[model samples]
Target: MAAPLDLDQLQTFVMICDTGSFTRAADEVHRTQSAVSMQMRRLEERIGKSLFEKDGRSNRLTEEGERLLSYARRLLHLNRETLAAFDDRSLEGQIRIGTPDDYADRFLPEIMARFARSNPRVELTVICEPTPGLVEHIKRGNLDLALVTHNDARQSEVVRREPLLWVTSANHATHEREILPMAFGRPNCVWRRSACDVLDRMHRDYRVLFTSFSATVIAAAVLSGLALSVLPECALRPGMRVLGESDGFGLLPDCKIGIMRGHTANSEIVEALARHIAESLDNISVPSAEEAPAFDLAALSAMRGRRHKPANLMPGW
Candidate 1:
């Protein structure tokens, strides 16, 4: 077996990678530059390979260094979790969670509120971002757990998926001419791609009238009829309603929701938090078109009809 590596040295290496400079890493780790250098030297000797490439002014990780970075991050996270568990098995510790913008905006607040009522002593910190970014943060050990869409072939390994629905304004004019416009998320977003694929396969002509990275912005746009977009049932709002049957639109493939753990070694509090989050999400209601406001496509067309506006049309026209 390979010799056991020093956890402190690995921590130093991780700090260096995160901060990208020894001077900064030393400041963060509360060690002098020379002492930090000594730790690295000793670590390198133990590993029998240079972890970083130092040219006059710039510092970069060697290939071995890059490989070690991933392992070191996981190790440090495990170490922290281990210490936290020994300190307290009761769910009264800080839990840092990362969620997608839409999930954070619509569903997380209520679920977290319930959790807070039950565990008043536990501190919760939530970070919101796109699924890809959240996944990266979890992998980097920056978050104890994250809710995100899965990517790649390892898709089913760490993901739970739910059906999505298309929604639009309840009022519309031309049943045949209603060119559905929509506001969507950034390119890397799963919902955006799924919605577009379904429309294309159905031979439905639609246009993306606007795009925004924020979930709130997309919801606002949909309400204003700036465009129609597909979202999960949990996100349906007062003015927003489902457009079809739950399965009317075939399963939008499976947009995976990843539940990642920072470390499994000794993170009882965090594990409890993860379990709560997963259970809460799984229990959320999935509404169908019949359960939602009924749309009168033909009546909607007559109510406030949509007409094709040419590019050169006058501002008020």
Candidate 2:
């Protein structure tokens, strides 16, 4: 039988990948640089893969290293979770969590508040990427938990549902245009596909005015009279008006919110956080009567003017 991979070596591998220096990784992990190199050599022999190759003055991950990274991260995460689960003491580690940009503003505050209060010792690191990106993160063990827009094929827990609404600026008549101009997510966004499919069926003359992965970017366009957009109920901001069948818009299917967890997300605190997320979303009495906080036009304009754009979606996303 093949020998099991060493947790210590895997941790070293991940540390080297993160810090981008063998010497730095050795210092952090309390090992001599030669010992670190030896660990990597043993790991390569065990896996029969050349994980890294020297490039000029630095070492870069070989294709095999990239593949092993995901597995290494998962194994390390699961090991930590397992130890934490068996311990009698309160959980005390950082949890990496993820959500779509659209859900971050609407759902995170309350959920984060609840989790922090309940698990004071546990640290939370949040990542805001779209659903497909979050899925990739989960697969790569970059995130321990994720809240995603649920669909039939995704392997996640559907925790809540809300209407997908057509929204326009209350102060603008953008939706009334003869050829409807719309702001939408990338082509793979489920909401974008739905909106496009409905428009095609109705033979509605519509053109995509803006394409972005950031919900806020799209929301800015919607609120500034730049275009119309379809967003889930929670994404509605103040000064946005909903369009319905009465406004010549077709019906859209309900949006389902889901929770994605690491394959080995069995730690007590992880489960506790999942419960908090579900309870928070289920108790929507707080947000139902009000819109999420809005970014004013000036702020959004500045955001657009910045050279830094939102992260690009992964390939095939």
Model 2 off-target regions past 4 Å?
Answer: 1-88, 264-266, 286-317
Estimate the TM-score of every prediction.
Answer: 0.55, 0.63
- lDDT, residue 121, candidate 2: 78
User: What residue pairs clash in candidate 1, if any at all?
Assistant: 172-300, 172-301, 173-300, 173-301, 181-227, 181-228, 182-227, 182-228
- Model 2 — TM-score against the truth? 0.63
Q: Runs in model 1 with CA error above 4 Å? A: 1-89, 151-161, 173-179, 245-251, 254-256, 263-266, 287-317
Model 2, 115-149: lDDT tens digits are: 66556678999999999999999898888899999
- How many residue pairs collide in each prediction? 8, 0
